[model samples]
Target: MRHPHPLPPPGHAEVRIVAATPEAARLIAEALRRRFAATEQRSYPAGGEGGTRLHLTVDTTHTAAAPRPWPATGEASGARRLQADEI
Candidate 1:
């Protein structure tokens, strides 16, 4: 099995985009490519779940969201869009 937390090769950075749709993921990747100059990208199907995400490898430092928040106690009322520092 693939390691859950694989490190990027030296001098490269990885960025993951978890979105509700493949188009959303592609848009995010395109935006990042314009800004960060990503060198590589791959999209992964999230199995039975209804979303997709893209992993981008860039030649620069990448920032990730802070640790995810504790699970909500009940059904989610609405989507939560969070920033990197507000994870």
Candidate 2:
């Protein structure tokens, strides 16, 4: 049997969006534009012998880059638990 494609890491993802109306599809594509390198929407004829149908395909994919070095030369800085009185 065929297996589904596995997802990437937490910072990486792929999305395939399909909508009947242009407006609805555009809204989805716009919202996710920043998270992906490219968002492409296209029209295609429906499978039938009669009239054509309107459909939108919004396909986008994102891949995370390699980890970068810390900016500072000192030890790492992180948050610490505060005392009850501090709260």
Candidate 3:
């Protein structure tokens, strides 16, 4: 069967994320969103067993190239560092 939303030419790709629940599928898709320029996700039922299938297209040529570096020791960013005892 033909996919309803076909990926645009060469630089784009189709990504499918399948999981036992919609929330689980979305969590993975959310992680992809942080690393690339992607389309909004579309979800569908995977099967009779209640799984979720999510689809989205990502632009390979466009990405989050410069992610912010982690603040050294948290104190550098004025955030308090959690002490091991807090855990």
Model 3, runs deviating above 4 Å: 1-7, 65-87
Model 1 lDDT, full chain set: 0.73
Model 3 weakest 10-residue run by lDDT: 70-79
Candidate 1 lDDT over 1-87, as tens digits, reads 788988888767788889889988888787667656576678898668889978888755543333445467554534766757885
Error of 2 at 2 (Å): 1.6
Per residue, candidate 2 scores C-alpha lDDT tens digits across 1-87 of 555966554544455555555555556665555445443555444345332333222233342233456545455434455557886
Q: Which stretches in model 1 have alpha-carbon errors above 4 Å?
A: 1-6, 9-11, 61-87
| Tens-place lDDT digits, model 3, residues 1-87 | 888965578988889999999988998898778888899999999989999999999888898555656666555533576789897
Q: Please list the C-alpha lDDT of all candidates, in the order they appear.
A: 0.73, 0.48, 0.84
Q: Candidate 3 — number of clashing residue pairs?
A: 0
Pairs with backbone N, CA or C atoms under 3 Å apart (clashes), candidate 2: none
Residue 64 lDDT in candidate 1:
37
Q: What's the lDDT for residue 30 in model 2?
A: 59
